[model samples]
Target: MPAVTSAPADSQRPDTKPRRRVGRPAAAVLDQDGITAAALQLIQKSGYDGFTMAALARTLNVAPSALYNHVSSKRDVLVLVQDHLTSLVDVSAFESEPWERAVRDWAWSYRDVFSKHTPLIPVIAVLPVTDAPKTLAMYEAVSAGFSRAGFPQERIISAIVAFESFIFGSAYDVTAPADIFDSGSMAATTPHFTSAVARLAEQGFESQADVAFSLGLKALIAGLGGFRA
Candidate 1:
């Protein structure tokens, strides 16, 4: 039989590996733009009720401390998201177009953008105009157009608020069900409403929401213009 050598005993082996360093782990590069994009994605997916700092942190694959390095709180992130979305509204019309046309452009574009993000409406409706620079800038542009058109300063905000109320509700309407007015077997008893729904359907192939929105928006523009000095 051949002689064999025994390996070193477990406790007798030398420790050759270096210990790992304790420092910040590798993470995604974060900034306002990245945070806003991630926050918007998260909000679009889970909505406000499901949005949380910890949830956002997980979405970004970073620790909560890493997220805090940017935004101070959830509300800060919301203001960022709000400003970012508002920046997308076509306020350019306010620069070169007449007040009525500017209002129409702004209203239609604002509705279209928010219609896709209706989940943000509730939060935006109650949100203060402060801390959101882009949003404030949009208001400034629109207000300037209104002022040029002779709107009294005192009533400018009221007129804007009225348009916003209609716009937000219309955004929700854009997402309403196609058969929401079907009425089913109960239609026989609700003749007036049933007939109206039928007439609306026969009007055109354009989206019912679009038709109603256009009608309402025209009425709003003409009606709100009455506020002009």
Candidate 2:
């Protein structure tokens, strides 16, 4: 047999590069935006009860351990979502308008944002702003507005808290059915209440909730005057 030269060693081969590994592409690196977006979708579709580290990881196509690299826990993801929601609130009016007007605008914006994420209200309401830079920044702007509007330093937080409580409740109300207060057979026994309900319809407002929210918000804003320095 003719001498058979062995093929050159693989490492010494000419015009040959290492075999390109053909398999699934690497998973995209997880980042805060991707995490926040996935979390929001999961919450919207499944509610808070369905949100979990494992679920989040699955949604991101990664192991649960991978999530810990970016977020310490589910609560950390919540903080991201909360900060994003807060950023949507229109606080710009504070710069040009009177404090009351600015607050009114901000309240409407705040209520609108939270109404869509009602399930998160309780979580965010109690969440501390310690590590949430955007949340802290929102408070700083509102605080400065309140300060300029003559709110006492000691009472600024209280005023903000009170306003937030009303905003949150109003947000929930936005999701209520039009006949949520319908007393049915009991309407006959509660004459005053039944009459009020009818009168609300007679008023020709586009939305009962909108009308109620507007009336209550105006009253609340006016009442906040008591907190001003």
Candidate 3:
């Protein structure tokens, strides 16, 4: 028999150059634009809690580990999505405008964005809005408007805070669950609840609430004038 001496494992192996893992690696897809777009779509459709690594992986047709190479976690994705959305706010677009008009425009723009991202409202409500770059841009824009009008630093900050708070609070109110307002159970048991319901029925609660919100916001803006004192 020919000396079929067992060849070494290495010798038996085909000597073809080890196939360089050719083609774009998974890391290639994790760039800022791709990830940010995916995150924004997810946010717009399902909100923050609905986003997951698995969903993102499926969206990009990559492994979950691939995302970690770009973003640390879903929270990081959320932050990026927020920053991208915030960047659309162009304060300079309203530049050289009157201070009150600038402030009102800024406030309305902020309100519109937050309302669209209702799920993000709570996240934005608590997170320091100044942390994001676009948010900072908006801050600078508002600050510039206030500064130009001779408003002090503290007042500028306060006005920004109050405007955001009012808008967010109203958005929450409109979106709050009806179960939360179920006075039926209490109305039957509590005299205070009963009286309040009677008054609400007589007063046209919905109209009153709408009027109150409008007046309240106007009052808030007027109160900012006091900031100059």
Give the Cα-based TM-score of candidate 2 against the true structure. Answer: 0.89
Which ten-residue region of model 1 has the weakest summed lDDT? Answer: 19-28
Instruction: State which candidate, 2 or 3, has the greater TM-score.
Output: 2
Residue lDDT tens for model 3, 167-197? 7776555555534545776676788776865
Model 2, CA-based lDDT = 0.90
Q: What is the C-alpha RMSD of each candidate to the true structure, in Å?
A: 5.5, 2.9, 7.5
| Candidate 2 residue 40 C-alpha distance from true site, Å | 0.9
Q: Tens-digit lDDT track for model 2 on 10-98?
A: 78888655877798668858999999999999998899999998999999999888889999988899999988988888888888899
lDDT to native, each model: 0.91, 0.90, 0.70
lDDT of 1 at 65: 98
User: After aligning candidate 2 to the native by TM-score, how far in Å is the CA of 141 from where it should be?
Assistant: 0.6
- List candidate 2 stretches off by more than 4 Å: 1-26
Per lDDT, the best of the predicted structures is 1
Number of residue pairs clashing in candidate 3, backbone atoms closer than 3 angstroms, sequence gap of 3 or more or interchain: 0
> How many steric overlaps are in each model, in order?
0, 0, 0
Steric clash count of candidate 2:
0
Q: By TM-score, who's the top model here? A: 2
